[model samples]
Target: MNNGTPHNTTGTMSANVSYYNENFVANSKFAIVKYSDRFFLQACMAFEGVSQYIDFWIPANIPGDGSIIELSLAANGGNLASYSRFPDGVALRARSGRLLMKYDWQTKRMEGNFSFEIQNGSTIVQISDGTFDLTGIVDGVSNSSIYGVGTFTAYSDQLGSFEAQEVSIELKDRSHVGLPNYWQIIGRMEKPEFPHPQRSHIALQVVEHVETKIHTLGNNPDAWASYFQEPDVGIIPAVNGTLEFTTLPNTGHTEGRLDADFRTAENVLIHVSGIFDIKQAKR
Candidate 1:
């Protein structure tokens, strides 16, 4: 993404915060070429960050080997550097209209609507509420701009469709302040394939296997505790029996959908893919 748009990067703090909020319009295009029976996809993402906007273009032409992509920041080799939450650098093997998005540190009350496409020529449009936390390690201990994850739920009528869109990282009211506002995940879906009627009986099993405690000291050192345990005895495990799940019949892969929601210690709510695996137990 290239933009004649200008950026503003002016800050003074102990930890350097790379600013990417400069307003600029980046135009990107994609072209898929078919040379043989296989199809190769090429995509480019351009956006303004810090001093200047950079371009990330990737081309994948090898059959069965998968595609490759990269992100380039600061075209003129400026002093500023941009960072992505995604540890894998640029998203690889992404289909058209597929994106891995996250909010910047400076953004607050992040809310937006976006669309995601699936392999079956279908799309999922989602609107979500952003999540946040006040644990800014780089901005010193007194910064108000919190960074964390958020929960999301959207409705769609399309069957057998699963996709994630409209993501953000933002702060919320004080009601969510310091309440162990940890992660909670729940999922429900339909079952598409059932070879054996009785054999196909399935249910989701949720485990609260982990927990972390945070104690903030006033302009002092931080303390915490961590542990792993099973689901609470009184509470029934969060599970949706007979939800639609993906299947691979050729290699003996079968199961139902497994939806998950998790809140990190940093107040980030991550929606992990809940794919179930069901089969006979070993003798």
Candidate 2:
């Protein structure tokens, strides 16, 4: 389904896609396309669990550098942020600021940097010094190999917010025979508090597949989580205080939201919240 660029297509002459491009499937395509009097940007990228996206009203033309363009959750009855996980985004507005769009019409490229603010009821995302480029974006649909995606984010009262250096969430049932747990969400970060310069890895689990709910470690073995690291420091059988999926679970997709606060018998806290949509392992 790699249909190539939009160079030969009608009204799609000027288009490009800039993304991680890790998977060859449809999920790998993150694009921006503009034609006639509207701009459309759609992305499935992630900053760990907190994804930044736009799927709604964008001004029809370039406002030039050092100018501001208002963003609306509803314009012409269309949700600009169609992919946002926030519950209420109509009130989500940006900070009064200008985005410097250094666009090049001849090259069909656009680049800019701006930091804005938006909120969905109580959930707020302060887009800190965000930058974007659509010099090589896409203007076509994808194949049928991809589906839903999830989100993850976490905060600590003890320490500031942090993101995982790596994330690997999967279905334990696919890897383990007779394993009761249905899902395994794992993340890792650097830990200087430990003995050596090793990374701290945490993995959480849930017994049911319908949703990811908070579960205490000792309550039952059906739904639980654990933590460990390299060099065998110590292991912590853990519990989750908050866990949620962005949407209801369905077949062929495993994307949802997650927030977990787990600890060891030594009271070491391992907190993580993010979104994921890793495909179910092949049967």
Candidate 3:
């Protein structure tokens, strides 16, 4: 797979905090190229030993002559905005805001001003006089991955037990300022020529963890497992499962085990279990 590169540019960001009734200035400001067409902008501000930050995404096709963009939580309306006041461990989504953007064609830079209100339940936080001046804006792809060697074995009620011929893991970090860092681990186990009818391929996603922990699947949005079979069975999703990481990715290695129960459309329950020890490969 072709992994992308992350672009970080220097900038300055500042705002007025309503909760503390103080002017906030960020010590670190940057924009990450999240994709070829999108950028993740962030500003980290610290006040009284507590860290707070504001972030949002912007499209690659921003207007150069200063256009006002609406920031909201609407599904189809505007760009999303997020506010994090740390040690609090909760991120608030903006209910309403505005972003004014100006792109410099000559210097390949971006300048913007914004103000937003984010609310968690009944408590609302207001941010005002927000401004940022970023330089060296370059468009690029955002994520990098390192492949790992591993073994995966599983058993199903409908197809019995099988071992994957090829097992690989991909680690993608999606951390932003003011939020706890987490890695999105993608594990793939495949045996294309396996004799079993529905035991050819399996994929798992483990999201939101930086250390070894037990992750619950099925109704959990952060973790899940899936499998695919040819011809008739499309993709089956796990209804319940548990993924336990004994050792997380560090120093070029990781170890984990998984047990997942997948329910097919035909009402068949498939159980899968596997253990994996992966060594990261040199890129």
Candidate 4:
């Protein structure tokens, strides 16, 4: 079945493919194959119950040649993330070509030379004109040597293809609640019973105080209550203020100093101030 020869079809493309590539057969050695909008091959190979081997194959609709493969779980309905363990085993022997896979958050692209070992033999990888064709025995048999369209390396060592799971949360009527804001009255300067040269007493004035909290309201009412009840739930608060303080001298004259602290509900603190306001009050 080598050499552009359309081999016999065990199953049509529209039908579920029981084989791995053109040669890699789906044996009971690993796991079973499942199909949806995409095909998933899952298998777990155990060794001494300590070490494990696994393989997950996902077919790409990308036209083979030198085209970017866009993979996404139909369930999740987004671009597929780049996978590591699911290494690009398909080797294109030809030069002057680039193998591009979608970029995951960690890496920019998935590119590699595809190599295969068949029946206890050395790893053989063929590259012709920038096209990699992986044709090797999977389990001591060439019958299962199908060119892997793609694979996914799960975060766990276990191998398997996961369709993107669609998940969504909504807020019923909390559009008005919004984020949380906070303010704390800090230390205040005062004249001790023992008078000093600083003059009269210093009175604390709470010009303004604000508190805010941010959070995502769950779709269900119960879920929202549970979420808000948690010690830490919501977005960062956005609130500010202008604090003005005045000090009076027993001589019927007034002077003062001003200090302001800007803070978020998350307890993040900052000092923002200008100057104190000194004005005489008309009796």
- Compare the candidates by TM-score and give the number of the best one: 3
Deviation of model 3 at 253, angstroms: 4.6
Q: Against the correct fold, how does model 3 do in TM-score?
A: 0.52
TM match of model 1 to true structure: 0.15
Off by over 4 Å in 2: 1-153, 157-161, 174-181, 190-196, 208-218, 229-234, 248-252, 255-260, 268-283
Better of 1 and 3 by TM-score: 3
TM-score for each candidate, following the candidate numbering: 0.15, 0.33, 0.52, 0.17
Candidate 3 structure quality by residue, lDDT tens digits, 59-106: 666665555454443323336556655444334445567877777656
Best by lDDT: 3
lDDT, model 4, position 265: 25
Model 3 — which ten-residue stretch has the worst lDDT?
Answer: 1-10
lDDT per residue as tens, model 4, 225-282? 1000001111111123333224322222223332323222223333332232232232
Off by over 4 Å in 1: 1-180, 193-283
Candidate 3 residue 215 C-alpha distance from true site, Å:
9.1
| lDDT computed for candidate 1 | 0.21
Give the poorly placed runs of model 3, Cα more than 4 Å off: 1-8, 20-22, 32-34, 46-49, 65-76, 143-244, 250-281
Q: lDDT of each model, Cα atoms only?
A: 0.21, 0.40, 0.59, 0.21
What are the clashing pairs of model 3? none
Model 4 regions lying over 4 Å from their true place: 1-36, 42-45, 51-60, 66-283
What's model 2's TM-score?
A: 0.33
